[model samples]
Target: MDISLKNGYEELGVAWRRGCEFLGTDYAIMGGAMSWVSERHLVAAISNAGGFGVIACGAMTSDLLDAEITATRELTQKPFGVNLITMHPELDQLVNICLSHKVGHVVLAGGVPSKETIRRIKEGGAKAICFAPILALAKKLVRTGADALVIEGMEAGGHVGPVSTSVLAQEILPYITEVPVFVAGGIGRGEAISTYLRMGASGCQVGTRFVCAFESIAHPDFKKSFIRANARDAVTTVQVDPQFPVIPVRALNNEGGKKFIETQHNVIARYRAGEMDLATAQLEIEHFWAGALRRAVIDGDVEFGSVMAGQSVGMVKSEQSTADIIQELVAQAASAFSDHEVIRSNP
Candidate 1:
């Protein structure tokens, strides 16, 4: 792969171009934060390797987040960020914890972030990154002071939105120029990253491929599942009852997923029988997977734990170092640039 003419993918849009500058990293690639999977070791390794790393604060208390941030700082002196879910009960305190630690970046995921949350992050001298589910929301997030946006598609692992990456890029990128937009979901290789950057994304966020990283603490069985599975093996949960809201989550199909379907049916039937109210029944359904991810990631219960994974799980063939993964993606992107140049020159 002759990448001499690629020029390090400098053709990406200005917003993402500035996003790299804002992140203070050599590359704009961000290791998407996955619950129970992203921790100090993986986060530090990603940052030290030149791509951005974000600590996933899924259901973590303020004290835990503080300790995680302190530990990550000790591992690598490079810049890294913390990903805080919007629905977190301790949202304010978590933001305050990041502020107290002088964290460089805070990514707000799970839902649209409130303006006050965005303001607090920015006012604390940290960059605020929000998830944009649609073009309108992308523009609105910018208006609310989001420094950058991550447009994640349904093909992503864990909790996901409805749109695909390709369609979201087409719909949101051309219109929203206020901030850099990082495309996520279904991005498996460097070529795809290059394609999104050319389409106006500032960079890309990847999760599934990194789940098996050598630095990742995910259980061996969980990593093995990712390695052995193909894209088709990852499917989103379907809503068994329309009355109860079901936010689709992508994961490797296993015994846990099968049981979750049955569990939902029973819970919905109880609700319909007037034995339980809507909220309590919904909570019962949601709580089914509460501690399940941890079971898969830490306890090696792949058979009955949530093995959250994106479609890109198919490309994760082995457990490599985080540096190797970043280098591979960078090299692939550079090669794609060179290939494009060759075709343009020939034409």
Candidate 2:
């Protein structure tokens, strides 16, 4: 569990491009944004450790989001980003909050970033980072003024695109013209990050791994659940069928999730009868999540909640500080770059 800097890949650093600069950092990693979990403490902690951290915007009012931004500024003078769900009605106000606080970057998640929205972000002096499901979408987002791209795969948590990270990365990387790509989904260990770095990704946006970090605010049960999870522990299921389109999310399968499927029918039936609202349905969906995470992370209910983890969870066996994790990941990347096997094997 110990990664001694002396015995590992020396001169570890990640080269990346964001906005107008090709920047290099001690580590090419980001603490992925998790709903109701990411805050100033966690974001700042990761950024201070030489990795990017994104604050999650699950259900924050303008005032509270502003406060969180201010607190993050107070915590670290280093760079960080704010993750905003595009479907949220108050998206503009939240974007402004980040601008006013001088947050250098804003990561738009859950949906596409519109041209107007990207224009507004530019006007506010913040760089836009948007997620794309495919190469076409990635190109479109770059045209819309996205400073960079977060290409997510089907293995991601919450609302996600149908494509797997492998397909998405392969389809998009070479085709996209300018903006740098940050791969999201199913990343859990130093070796995985190293693999992606070799795959033309600028860095890895890691949400689930950060959830298990000591500083995350998710119920202790949630963190502990991740502690014991292997790759097979997580699965994605359908809760509500959207008539427009459907996307699958990866999560831990448990009794609570099974109960949720049964409840989804009753709830959707009420919605169809015009007796329930979208907000109510959303609450019910998260209710299942809270209960499940409560069981897995809190009550030692590994078989109890819908724990969301990436496929690489099998590679993790112990928890370490954010700094230690970054160091190890970057060291691995450096080793991979220097290793002669790939060179010698090539004709």
Candidate 3:
């Protein structure tokens, strides 16, 4: 690398060095844990490429998670974390599995984790990382002994909050300084990562961009859907009736998405007619997409499965190696500084 570029890279490193140290990775960039897609192969690949990888323990049983951690360990000696859904039936057992494997970091995602969950993770000697959608929750997580925080905005794929990434960063980044805060949602480029780091974020998390990584086990059809999508193509699920209260999920619009709207309407109608109680109606609506993500990701059901993707899906052009993807992001971030140095010297 040229001295100017080297300097630029070093500057970028300095900005996210806290994240690097916390994650024990070469770069502060974290691979977003997309269930069914972020398995052992992709997780290990991201870590091996100098970025932190996280296993998505979404709905995985204790034995399943145990085997996955072991498989990922065989692939990469680098540090990686496991993401556990707070709503999982066996959350405690999953945590135990991670601790047994001596995982360095544990990301508690899906919803606000209980203080006891955070305490247990820390007590097991692994750092606890939680997602804070808003400023108030960010502070609460910190007080609850969260070692790190990831502020994910609505633009992110899968389940999301209402705010945009930029807005969330501004709201939570400044207030939560006790621990490292990683920014997520719609972050596809290195420039965005650099911008967040400059804004006092310790690092950034990316998911949609990694779906097309060569190491990802997602169906080819799934990757093609991402490649063919524009920002507008990736949209959040719409609720036909506000009373039923469907959680907003950002995903590529498809037949399944359209069906989801119809399903919500049907469920609401049945509830209004007294065919079922409100709880049963809501349960039916939620169950509609239960296995939808896995269908699209693993079984090539792009037309009907939930193809979750962020607004950054538009930025993914082609399938590339995990290392190449990380390198591109790093290069893009470093170039900003290099360009500035070149201008300064010539002037």
Candidate 4:
């Protein structure tokens, strides 16, 4: 390790990092689970590199999730986690799969988690992590037995909340003391991570940066999109009609995104012509990108597929191993402390 890196870790007090103890990782950093991108290879790489990695179980069958967990185990003995959407039809079965694998942690994403779901995760002896978009939700998640909270802001990729990461951190970090709070959204470097930690965040959940990791399975074209993108290029989809609720999805602006707006317009026309009800129209709109992320991620269709990325995509200049990414972030974070002159000077 470089002397500056060692000095950086010392300044942050490695042992005192909030999420490190609970996550059982050397660093409190967590590789955000990206569907179609986060799999056994990437997840294990992150864990082996000393950061917690999470398998994204997006719309997978219980058997598939089981296979993924098992594959990850074969790759690394270090603790990792599985992120399951709460709305999954087989939610409980997925929880069981996690338990069967002796998974250390389970994260519930997409919506508010039910008590039964949280209970199942805990009862199975795995830590329950949930997203807290607001302060009230943060408190509720903690009370519902969630072992920790991930307060993600709207700057995140894919599905996102309306709040910005900085605002969310200020609102939720100050009052939430019962459990560790990890901040996410637009976090592309260690300086931002260190800033959040100083503001009472236990650690950070990062996604955009890892999307282009050498171990990530994202298509080469998708990686190129990230490499070429600037913060301004990542935009959210908008709902054409007010009657239909907009699901703000952050992704690289491309032909697919433009066509999605056209799709919404068509759906709205159907609703107006009395050919479709509001509910059906909304469903049609939502289904526009049913397999778009996979198309972009797996097939390298960057121009017409959902190239989901955060504002931080602008910062990813090249692909590196997961270990190198983690080390770079840690060194950057540690350097923040040194630059602040927080490190004690030798007398």
Candidate 5:
């Protein structure tokens, strides 16, 4: 281990990998890609604070995505990545733009990324990252040339997998032959990051933490909900089977959640009448969220919008700059490490 104790102090650069630049900091951590919520300014803020920030591509057009990449470059010369949902109609175009920008990395979320897509990303000299819910998928992604993997436990907001992060990270880390593992989902504080790192993760990729950052574009109301939330407030809705497939995601157990259930029944009714196809209905599910999220995050309608949040929302207290949040989190993680060592060394 390259543990340095220079100047009677602990610098994050000394403890973490200090080679690559993301935003203006070293390559020790990354902010996860969040949809409809992660935009240019917030992404740049995370990068500026020394962590790699990935721009989410859910609501942008191909041309808009290109513009965002260009805008991000103007914000900071530090390295960053772009996220592309594999199932989108414009996935190819979005991927091409990221390649053209020479993005430091590319995170492919949504469905399982194709082998061809992974190959293209690697060929363009960019590291390919993907989310794998289970061990089998993680192995397959590694074989398909994934440079890294994000294992999202059920506690994550917006389309989390079924397994817990504890179980999934432990299951996948040891067997991975090439790709480095990152634990996401429900990680909001300094202590949580340390806890996961000790579990064999190379680093942590945080999402919900960034959501509350002052720079985040999520509506003010949304941030307030985050501040008010505790672990008990975050809950996953009952499986809303859309007759196609449903990825159970965690969120606040609010009126929006109940409405989603009623909406699903409507979808089932509409499906029988041939008014909607599975794809449209699925998109509708996502669409329903946008208005509410926009209202909640931007308009201040906390109760109406689908306030997608992880279990760690309870830990978040206030809106701070991205750098302050990052620095605080790192400090917390270091503290945990020190305390753990003291306990183990005693007696």
Candidate 6:
């Protein structure tokens, strides 16, 4: 590498080195744990490429998650984390499974985790990472022994909050400095990553950008949908009735999403007529997309299955090797520093 490029890379590294140290990876970048898409292959590839990879333990049995951790270890010696949904029935068993494998980090997502849960992860010798959509939750998580925080905005794929990434960063990053905070949602390029690092974010998490990685097992049709999408095409699922409250999930607008809206309407009507109770109606709405993500990712049913993607999906034009993707992001971040050096010298 040229001397200037080396300096640029060094400068970029200085900004996120704290995150790198926390994650034990060469780069501070984290591969967002997307259900179905973030399995062993993609996870290992991202870790091997110097970015931290996290396995999405979505709806997986304890036995399945155990096997996945074992398999991912075979492909890479680098560190990775596992994302466990907070509401998993076997949450304790899953935590034990990860600890038994000596997993270094465990991310508790979906909803707020109990303080005891955080303590268990820490006592088990793994760092606990939690998702904080707002500043209050971020502080509380930190107080409860969260080792790190990921503030994901509404632009992310899958279930998301109401705030945008930029707004959340502004609202939380300045106030929370007790632990490493990673920004996610709508982050596509290294330029954006660099911007966040400058704003005191320890690192950034990227999901939609990695969905089309060459190592990704996402079906060809699923990858193609991402390639052809525009930012506007990725919209959040709608909730017809506030009483039946549906957690908004961002994905490519498809028949599945439309069906979800219709499903909500039907379920809410039945509840209004006293045909089913509120809990049953809510479950019906939630179960509509239970197997939909897997259908698109594994079965290539892009037309009707859930095509979860962040607005950053528009930036993913084609499939690239995991290593190349990481390299491109690094170069883009380094170039920002190089440009600063050039301007300073000329001035």
User: Model 2, 1-347: lDDT tens per residue?
Assistant: 23333322442343343311422344557677875667888888888888887888767889999988888889887788899989889998988888888777888987887898889887988888888887777888888888888888877665666678888888887777487788888876666665666667777877776776666666666666666777777777664666312245577666766776777777777877998787786566556555453455445565555566666665556666767766666666666555534455575
Instruction: For residues 277-338, write the lDDT of model 1, one tens digit per residue.
Output: 99999999989988899999999999998899999999999999999999898878877777
Off by over 4 Å in 4: 1-7, 14-16, 342-347
Give model 3 RMSD, 1 decimal.
Answer: 1.4
Model 5, residue 74: distance off in Å is 1.3
Give the lowest summed-lDDT range of ten residues in model 5.
1-10
Q: Write down the TM-score for model 4.
A: 0.96
Model 2 Cα displacement at 297 (Å)? 7.4
Q: Arrange candidates by TM-score, descending.
A: 3, 6, 1, 4, 5, 2
Which model, 2 or 6, shows the larger TM-score? Answer: 6
Q: Assess candidate 6 and give its TM-score to the true structure.
A: 0.96
lDDT of 5 by residue, 250-307 (tens): 7777888888788777877797789988789777765655566667666767776778
Ranking 1 against 2 by TM-score, winner: 1
**Candidate 6 lDDT, 190-261, residue by residue in tens:** 999988998999999999999999999999999999999999999998988888787888999998888788
- lDDT for model 4 comes to 0.91
CA displacement after TM-score superposition, residue 166 of candidate 2 (Å): 1.1
Candidate scoring better on TM-score of 1 and 5: 1
Please give the CA lDDT of all the candidate structures: 0.90, 0.71, 0.93, 0.91, 0.77, 0.94
Compared with the true structure, what per-residue lDDT tens digits does model 3 show for residues 1-347? 68999989988988889999999999999999999999999999999999999999999999999999999999999999999999999999999999989999999998889989999989999999999988888888899999999999888999998999999988888888999999999999998988898899999999999999999999999999999999999999998877778888999999999899888888888899999998899899989998999999999999999999999999999999999999999999888867766888899
Model 1, C-alpha of 261: deviation from truth (Å)? 1.0
Model 5 TM: 0.87
* TM-scores for candidates 1 onward, in order: 0.96, 0.83, 0.97, 0.96, 0.87, 0.96
lDDT of candidate 1 at residue 230, scale 0 to 100: 98
lDDT by residue for model 4 over 261-286, one digit each (tens)? Answer: 89998889888999989889889898
